[model samples]
Target: MENKIHFQYLIDGDDFTRAGEASSDIKSKLKMMNINPDAVRRVAIAMYEGEINMIIHADGGTIDVDVYPDKLTMVLKDTGPGIPDIDKAMEEGYSTAPDNIVSLGFGAGMGLPNMKRASDEMEISSVVGQGTTVTMTVLF
Candidate 1:
């Protein structure tokens, strides 16, 4: 198998139904690559959370993934109402989502926490009116 592979996914804004598609596809690819189950699940869960966040908070975004022998790296970039306070957003059970989103079984305030828990490292950068970018890495 190749030592590395690259993939990109475009998230559709406000499309909660399709939010996890990219992560699902990535999981399949990892399975085909014969990667460890734990590694694949970590990557999938982290990426899925990021994907949903991009849709819910950032309108839409692009996900770039680099699959390697011993690690997985994902970059999620989006242009929307950027985070006003990253520290607050990172706190568990903190969410700025509207009531409607909360009704859909999402926006449970678990996205960031889940992503952080699933990845070895995660970095998020944002500007109030500009945009946000989240980078996550999981070690196999």
Candidate 2:
């Protein structure tokens, strides 16, 4: 484990207040570790998007983060109603968020797109009635 740090967080469904907690914590840690500011910003944005998705769509889930000298990786997993169409979901402004969520000023359909744009690489796996797992990485 040469210069590697790992962390795990549990997200509460419908908890808009806590949606960005994990990402904020990670950002603080990264800054304390003297990580590149650009990389830290990317990680925070991507992770925060994932957290918001879990709260709105997945009804809660877990996020795992691994930080290393050369890169950082994040894995977000949720057991909520899985995505039926990944390709369509990838399209910007294509969101399945409920009306109530939209009313709260969230779920603008940009979560996944922003996450992908912030990360060096991203992968998503989902099962219709099972769950969704998103993995993202940013290189320093």
Candidate maximizing lDDT: 2
Task: List all candidate RMSDs to the true structure.
Answer: 1.8, 1.0
Off by over 4 Å in 2: none
**Candidate 1 residue lDDT tens string, 31-66:** 999989999999999998888888888888899999
lDDT tens digits by residue: candidate 2, 66-117: 9989999999999999999999999999999989888877788999999999
Cα distance off (Å), candidate 2, residue 76: 0.2
Clash statistics: count for each candidate = 0, 0
lDDT of each: 0.90, 0.93
The lowest-lDDT stretch of 10 consecutive residues in candidate 1 is 97-106
- Point out where model 1 deviates above 4 Å: 1-3
**TM-score per candidate:** 0.95, 0.96
